[model samples]
Target chain A: MTAVAAFAWSVLQDALHRKVFYAILAFSLLLMLLIPMLPSASVGVQVDLLREAALGLTSIMAFLLAVIMASTIIPGELGRRTLYNTLSRPVRRWQYYLGKFIGIMAVVAIALLVSLVVLLILVGAKFGTFNPGLAKAIFTIFLEAMVLASVAMLASVYLSPLVCILLAGLFYVACHVKGDFLYRAMTDSTNHALLRGLSGFLYYILPNLERMNINETIAHSERVFRVGAGELVLLSAIALVFSAIFIALGAYLFERRDL
Target chain B: MEAVLSVEELHKAYRTRLGGPRRQALSGLSFTVPRNSVVGLLGPNGAGKTTTLKCVMGLVRPDAGKVSLFGRDGDAVEARRRVGFLPEQPYFDLYLTPRKLLHYYGRLSGMGASSARSRISYLLNLVGMEDDADLTMDKFSKGMLQRIGLAQALLAEPELLILDEPSSGLDPLGKLEMRDVLKSLGTGGTTILLSSHQLSEIEEICDRVIIIHRGREVASGRLDELLEEKGDCEVLLAEPAPGATSGLPSSASWAEDSGGKRLTVSREELSAALTALIESGASIAEVRSRRLSLEEFFVRRIGKTGWEVEE
Candidate 1:
C-alpha cells in the first residue's frame, strides 16, 4: 500500500509540472467568466443561464483532464524507459497500475473542485446568492469522468495515447446512445439476427454513461427532476463497479506483457 | 563459492514485426554469478546481454529454463528485494530532483521516512551529486543522469547489484570515479554483474568475465587466464650484426617496438628462431609467451568477421 501511495504521489507531482494541466484549467475559467457578456445570455433566466454555461465549461475541463492523463501516463513512462526503475523494485505490477488510476482520479477531483469554487464565487457575485446545490452536478460529473478515465487507461496498455483517446471518445458516444439506440436495434422485428446479436452484446457490456449527466437538472432553478441522495448512492455504486472491472482487466494484461 | 545468481538454458524470442517470424534473442544461454565477486558480462550489441539481465530482473519472461537468486525463483518479489538494477542509459522524470526521486524510490523499496531520508543523503554524496541534489534534473547532462541512476540503484542497500553499460556516457574522469566506486563496493562484499562494451573498463575492474556470443556462453573464466596465449611465444632482439637478416626464420613475424624489434613465433618455431639469432651474433633481449590484451583476446575469440557483422 505504501508503494502504491508513493507511485500515486509521484504522478501527482509529475502532473503538476506539466503546463497543459494549468492551461486547460485557466482556459476553462476564463471562458466561464466571459459567459455573462454574451448578448443572448441576458434575454433568459440570467442565473440559470450562467449556471448552465459554467457547469458545461467545468464538465469539459474535467473530462479533458481525466481522459488525457489516463491515456498518456502509462505509454509516456514506457516510451521514456522510466518504468524500468519503478517496476524493478519489490512492487507488483498491479500496485503500479492501480496507483496510476487513483492518481488520475485525484487530479480530476482537484480540477473539478477548483472549477467548482470559481463557479460558486462567480454565481455569488453575479446573483447575490450562494447555491450549494451545485455540488450534485459536480459530483455526477466526477462519477462520469471516472468511468471514462478507467476505459481510457485500459485501452492505454495496448494502444497508443492518440488511439486510446479516440477509442475512449467512441466508447463514450456508444455507451451514451446504447440505452436508447441499441434497445430499438435489438427489438426491431425487421433487423437481422447478427445485427441484433451485436447490439445486444454491446448494450449488456457497456456502462450507461448517460445516466450520470445531471447538469441541466441541477443548473435550472426549478427542481423539475431533483437529484436525491438515493439516486447519487446508486449511481456511485454503478460507477465504482464498472471502473473496478476495467482496472482489474488492465492490471492483468499489464502484468503479462514484457516491459 | 556460493552462487548469488544462476541462469540455466534460458531462451527468449521476440517478434520482429506484428505477425512476423520470431527472432531468437537468447538461445540456451547459461551462466552463474558468484557471490562477492565482480563479474563482467561481455558481448557485442546483438549478443543478448541486456536480455539476460532483463530476465534476471524479471522484466522479460524467458520462454525456457529458470533463473534462481539465492535459492529462490528469480520472479519472486522476495528475491528482487535484495537486488538492485541499473538499465542501459537510465532515464528519470525531469521534473523530479535527485532528493525527491530517491525518496520516492526509497518508499517503494519499503523504507521509512527517517531511514529513507538518511539513505537518500548517503547515496547523493556517494554518487557525487550532493551539491546539485535539490536542483531539478531538466538540464542535467547524460553523465549527471548516470550518477543519479547509480544513486537510485543503491537506495535499497541491496546485496546484489546489476548494471548495464554503467560507463556508457561518462567522461574519462567520470569513468575513473565510477571504477573506483565499483571497486570499493566489490570490496565491501556487494556481488556485481556488469555488462559493458568498454573492454578496458571490464579488464580493470572485473576479476572474472562471462563472454557470450550469439546468445550462448563462448568463454567464462578468470580474466588473466583467458588472456594468456596457448601456443605462441614472443622473442625480442637487440642490435645485431649486418648479416643477421639472412639468418632470421621465415616463419617468424616481425614488428618494431620502442625497445627494439620483436618476433612472434609458434612454440615449435621458437627454438629455431633463437638459434638463428644466436648464430647471427644478435643479443637476445627477452623471451616470453605472447600476452594478449583483452581487446585482442575478444577479437580472436569472436573473429573479425563476427565483429563486422555485429557492427
Candidate 2:
C-alpha cells in the first residue's frame, strides 16, 4: 500500500506539476470569469444562463481532461520506456494498473476541484448563494471521468493509441446515446434474443448520461426531482467497479505481453 | 554453484489473426545459467537470445517450460527482487534526470529510502556517470544512456544481472569499460547472463559461452574449448633475411599464403616448424593463431555447420 501510494504520488506530481496543467487551469478560470458577461447580454436569463454555462464548461472540461490524460498515461510511459522500469520490479501487475488509475484519478479530482472552486466564486458573486446541485454535478463528473479513463486504459492495453482513443470516444458517445444500441438489439430478428439480452443488460449497465446531464439541474428544479440519488450512486459505483475489473483484465493482458 | 536460472523446454507462441498461422517465438528452448559466472548467451539474429532472456526475466512466458531463479519458482515475485534486467532498447522518462531515474528504479527494486539514496550515489559513480547525474535522459548520448542503464540494472545490487546486448551501441572504449563492469560483477558473486551476437565482445567478457542456434543450444563451454575443437593452427613466422624464403628447412611443407610474405602450415606442423624455422636463422616477425572468433564459430556451427538441429 505504501509503495502504491509512493507510485501514485509520483504520477500525481507529474500530472499536476507540468506547465500544461497550469495552463489548462488558467484557461478554465478565464472561461468561468467570462460568465458575468452573460448578464450584460440578457436582463432576466443571467442567473439561469450563467449557471448552466458553468456546469457545461465543467462537464466538458472534466471529460476532455479525462480523455486527454487517459490517452497519454500508458502511451507516454511506453514512449519513454518508463513502463519497463516499473514492470521490471517485484511489483505485481495489478499494483501497476491500480497505481496508474489512482494517480490519474487523483489528478482529475484535483482538476475538478479547481474548476469547481472557480465556478463557485463566479456563482457567489452573481447570486450570493451556493447551489447544492453544483456540487452534485462537479462530483458526478469526477465519477464519469473515472469511468471514461478506465475504458480508455482498457483499450490501451491491447489496442494502438489511435484506436484506443477512438474506441473510448465511441464508448462515451454510446453511454450518452440512451437507447441506440439497446433499441437496435431488440428490433433485430437474427440473433434477436442474444442481441436483446445484451442490450437489456447494457440499459442498466451503462451510465445514463441523458438522465445525469447536469445542464438540466440548473435550468429547472422540476427536472432534478425525478432522479434519485441512490441510482446515481449505484450507477457510479458500478462504473467504478467495472473500471476496476477492466483494469485488472488489462493488467493480466499486459503482464503476459512481451514489452 | 547451483543453477541461478533454469528453463526446461520453454515455449512461447503468438497466434495473430492478421495473416499466417500462429508463430512460435520459442520452442524446446532449454538452458541453465550456473550461479556466479559471467555467461555469454551467443546466437545469431533471431536465434532466441532475447526470447531466452525475456523468459528468464518473466517478461516472456514459455508455453511448456519453467524458469526458476535462485532456486525459486519464476512466479515468485520476490525472486524478481534479486534480479536486474537491461532490455535491448531500454527507455526511461525523458523528463527524469539520471538521479531521478536511479531513484525510481531503486525504489521499485525494494530499496529503502536511505538505502536507495546512498545506493543511487554509489551506482551513479560506479558507472562513471556521477558527473551527469543531474542531466535529463533526453540530453544523454546513447553511450551515456547505456551506462545509466547499466547503473540502474545494478541499483538493487541484484544477485543476477540479465543484460541484453549491453555493448551494442558502445564504442570500443565504452565496450572495454562495460567489459570491466561485468567482469567485476562476476567477481563479486553476481550471476550475469548477457546476450549478444557480437561474438568478440561476448568472448572478451564471458567466462563461459552458450551458443543457441535457431532456438536450441548448439554449443556451450569455455571459449578455448570451442576454438580448439575447430582445429585451429598457430604459426610463428620467422622473417628470413631479404630474398631468403630459401633459408627454409626444405623439409618444412608450407605454402606462402600471400606471395611468400607469410607461410601457412597445417595444424599438425605448427610445433615442429616453430622450432625448425627459428633454427634456420629466421627471426619470427609475428606469432599469432586463428582462434575462431565467435562470429566465425556461429557461422560455421549454426549457420552452415550442417548440424542436424532438431529445433
Candidate 3:
C-alpha cells in the first residue's frame, strides 16, 4: 500500500508539471467564460442555458483530462525507462498499475474542482444567483470520466496512447448511445438478424453512460426530473464496479508482461 | 560455502518483432555468486549478460531454468527485499530532485522516515552527490545521473547489489571513484554481481569472473587461475653470453621484451633453461610461470572471429 501511494504521489507530481495538463484546463475555462456571449433564447431561461453550456464545457474538460493522462502515463514511463527503477523495487506489478490509475483520477479530480469553481464564479457574477445543485452534475461527470479512464488505461496496457484514445472515444460514443440507438437496432425488424444480435450483445455488455449525463437536468434547476441521492449512489456503485473490473484485468495483463 | 545468488540452466528467447522468429538470448547459462564476494559477469556484445541479470532481478522470466536468491525463488518478494539493482543507463523523471526520488524509493522499500533520511544522507555523500541532492535532474549530466542511480539502489542498504555497467558514461576520475566505492562495499560484506564490458575494470575489482560467449558460460573461476598459462614458464635474462642459443633446450622459445630479454619454455624445462643461462655466464633476472592479461585471456577464449558469426 505504501508503494502504491508513493507511485501515485509521483504521478500527481509529474502530471502537475506537464504543460499539456495546464493547456487543457485553461482552454476549457476560457470556453466556459465565453458562454454568456452566445445568442439567447429567452430572458428567463438565459441562466439555464449558460449553466448547460458551462456543464458541457466542464464535461469535455474532464474527459480530455482523464483519457489523456490514463493513456500516456504507463507508456511514457516505459519509454523513459523510469519504470525499471520503480518496478525493480519490492513492489508488485498490480500495485504499480493501480497507483497509476489512482493518480490519473487525482489529476482529473483536481482539474474538475478548479473548473467547477470557475463555473460557479462565472454564474454568480453574470446571473446574480448560486446553483448549488451543480455539484451533483459535476459528480456524475467525474464518475463517467473514471469509467472512461479505466477503459482507456486497460487499452493502454496493450496499445499506444493514440490508439487507446481512439478506442476509448469509440467506446464512449457506443456506450452512450446504447440505450437508445442499440434498442432501436435490436428491435427493428428492418435490420438484419446478425446486426440485431450484435447490437443486443453490445447493449447488454456496455454500461449506459447516457444515464450519467444529468448535466441539463441539474443545470436547469431540476425543472423536469431531479437526480435523487439513492439514484446517485446506485449509479456510482455501477461505475465503480465496472472500473474495478477494467483495472483488475489491466493489472493482470501488466503483471504477465515482460518489462 | 553457501551461494548468495545462483542461476542454473537459464534460457530465454526474444522475438525481433511481431510475427518474427524468436532469437535465443540465453542458452543453458549457469553461474553462482558466493556470499560476500564480488563476481564480474564478463561478455562481449550479445552474450546475454543483461538478459541474465534481468532474469535474476525478476524483470524477465526465463523459459527453462531457475534463479535462486538467498536460497529462495528469485521472483519472491521476500527475496527481492534484500536485493538492489542498477540497470544500464538508468533514467529518472527530470522534475524530481535526487533527494525526493530516493525518499520515494525508500518508502517503497519499507523504510521508516527517520532511518530513510539518514541512509539517504549517507548514500548521497558516499556517491559524491551531496551538493546536488536538492537540484532537479533536468540539468544533470550522464555521469551525475549514474551517481544518483547508485544512490537510489543503495537507499535500503541491501545485502546484495547487482549492477549493470556501473562504470559506463563515467570519466576516468569518476570510474576510479566507482571502483573504490564497489571495493569498499565488498569489504563491508555486501555481495555483488557486476556485468561489464570493461575487462580492465573487471580485472581490477573482481575476485572472480564468469566469462560467457554466445549465451553460455565458457569459463568461470578465480581471475588469476583463469589467466594462468598451463604448463608454461617465462624466464628472463640480463644479458646473453656468446653461444647461449645452442645451450638452450629445444622446448625453449624467445618471447617479447619489455627492457629485458624473455623466453618461454615448458614448466618441466625451467631448471635446464636456468642452468644453461648460468653456464653461458648470462645473468639470470626472474623466472615465473607465464600468465596472460585479462584481455588476452578473453580473446583467446572467444577467438579472433566474433561470436556474432558463430551465433
Candidate 4:
C-alpha cells in the first residue's frame, strides 16, 4: 500500500508539472464562465441554460482530463525510461497500474470540483439562488470519466496515445449510442442478420454510458424525476464494475509485458 | 562462497515486429554472482548484456529457465526488496529535484520517511550532488543525471546492486569517483553486477568477469587466473639496448618503453630469449609471467569475427 501510494503521488506530481494539464483546466473554466452568453428560449429557461451549459463544459473537462492523462502517463513513462526505475522497485505491477489509474481520476476529480465551484458561484451571483444540485451532475460526470479513463488506460498499455485516445473516443460514441441505436439495429428487420447479431453482441457487452448523463435533468432542477441516492449508487456500481474489468485486463497484460 | 544471484539457461527472444521473425537475445545463458563479489558483465554491442540484466531485474520476462536471488525466486517481491538497479542511461521526470526523486524511489522501496530523508541526504553527498539536490533535474547534465541515477539506486542501501554502465556519461574525474564509490561499496560487502563496454573500468574494479558473445557465455572466471592461463612471459631490461633483440628466439618480441627495453616470449622460448639477452649484455631488471590485459583477454576469447558481427 505504501508503494501504491508512492506511485500514485508520483503520477499526480508528474501531472502537475505538465503544461497540458493546466491548459485543459483553464480552457474548460474559461468556457464555463462564458455560458451566460449562450442564447436561451426565455427568461425562465435562462438559469437552466446556464446550468446545463456549465455542466456540459464540466463533463468535457472531466473526460478530456481523464482520458488524456490516462493515455499519456504509461506511454510517457515508458518512452522516457522512467518506468524502468519505478517498476524495478519492490512493488507489484497491479499497484503501479491501480495507482496510476487513481491518480488520473484524482486529476479529473479535481478538474470537476473546480468546475462545480465555478458553476455554483456563477448561479448564485447571476440568479441570486443557491444551486448545490450541480454537485449531483458533477458526480455522474466523474463516474462517466472514470469509465473512459479506464478504457483509455487499457488501450494505452499496448497502443500509442493517439490510438488510445481515438479508440476511447470511438468507445464513448458507441457506448453512448448503444442504448438507442444499437437496440434499434438489433431489432430493425431492414438490417442484415449479421449486422443485427453484431449489434446485439455489442449492446450486451458495452456499458450504457448515456445512462450516466443526467446534466439536462439536473440543470432543469430535476422536475420530471428526482435522482435519488439509490439511482446514484446504481450508477456508481456500473462504473466501478466496467472500470474494474478494463483495469484488470490492462494490469494482466502489463504484468506480462517487457519494459 | 554463497551466491547472491544465479541464472540458469535463461532464454529470451523479441519479435522485430508483429508476426516478424524473433531475434534471440539470450540463449541458454547462465552465470552467478557470488556474495560480496564485484562481477563485470562484458560483451560487445547487441550481445544480450542489457537483456540479461533486464531478465534478472524482472523488467523482461525470460521464456525459459530460472533466476534465483538469495536462494529464492528472483521475481519474488521480497527478493527484489533487497536489490537495487540502475538501468543503462536511467532517466526520470525532469521536473523532479534529485532529493524528491530519491524520496519517491525510497518510498517505493518502503523506507520510513525519516530514514529516507537521511538516506537521500547521504546519497546526494555521496554522488557529489548535494549542492544541486534542490534544483529540478531539467537543466542537469547527462553526467549529473547519471550521478542522480546512482544515488537513487543506492538510496535503500541495498544488499545487491546491479548497475548497467554505471560510469556512463561521467567525465574522467566523475568516472574515477564512481569507481572509488563502487570499490568502497564492494569493500563494504555489496554484491555488484555491472555491465560496461569500458573494459579498463571493469579490469580495475571487478575481481571477476563474465564475457558473453552472441548471447552465450564465452568466458567466465577470476580475472588474474584467466590472464595467467595464457602462459606468456615478460622480461624488463634496465636500459634501451637496441642489440637486446639480437639472436633472440623468433617467438620473442622486443619493445622499448620509458622504463626499459622489454622482451615478451612464449613460455617455451623464455629460457632461450633470456640467454640471448644476457649474451647481448642486456641488463635484466625483472622477469615474470605475463598477464593479459582485460582487452586482450576479451579479444582472444571473443575473437575478431565475433567482434565484427553487430549482433
Best candidate, TM-score-wise? 4
The estimated TM-scores of all candidates read: 0.92, 0.86, 0.96, 0.97
Indicate the docking level reached by candidate 3. high
TM accuracy, model 3 = 0.96
Off by over 4 Å in 2: A17-24, A39-45, A179-198, A209-215, A218-236, B14-17, B21-24, B230-291, B305-311
Please compute the TM-score of chain B alone for each predicted structure, in the order given: 0.89, 0.82, 0.93, 0.95
Clashes of each: 0, 1, 0, 0
- Give the C-alpha miss distance for residue B83 in model 3, angstroms: 0.9
Query: Model 3, DockQ value?
Result: 0.82
Report the backbone clash tally of model 3.
0
Candidate 1 chain A TM is 0.97
Which pairs, if any, clash in model 4? Answer: none
Error of 1 at A142 (Å): 1.2
DockQ of each: 0.80, 0.50, 0.82, 0.92
The fraction of reference A/B contacts recovered in model 1 reads 0.87
lDDT of 4 by residue, A167-249 (tens): 99999999999999999999999999999999999999999999999999999999997988999999999999999999999
Candidate 3 pairs with clashing backbones: none
Instruction: Report the C-alpha lDDT of model 1 over B110-154, residue by residue, as the tens digit.
Output: 889999999899988998999999999999999999999999988
Model 2, span A1-259: residue lDDT tens: 6557667777786876578777776777788788776536556657677777777777777777777777777777777776766777788766777777788888888888887777777777777867666767777778787888888887777677778778878888878874675656666777668777877777767766555565666544336464457867875786678677777777777777665
**Alpha-carbon deviation at B57 in model 2, angstroms:** 1.8
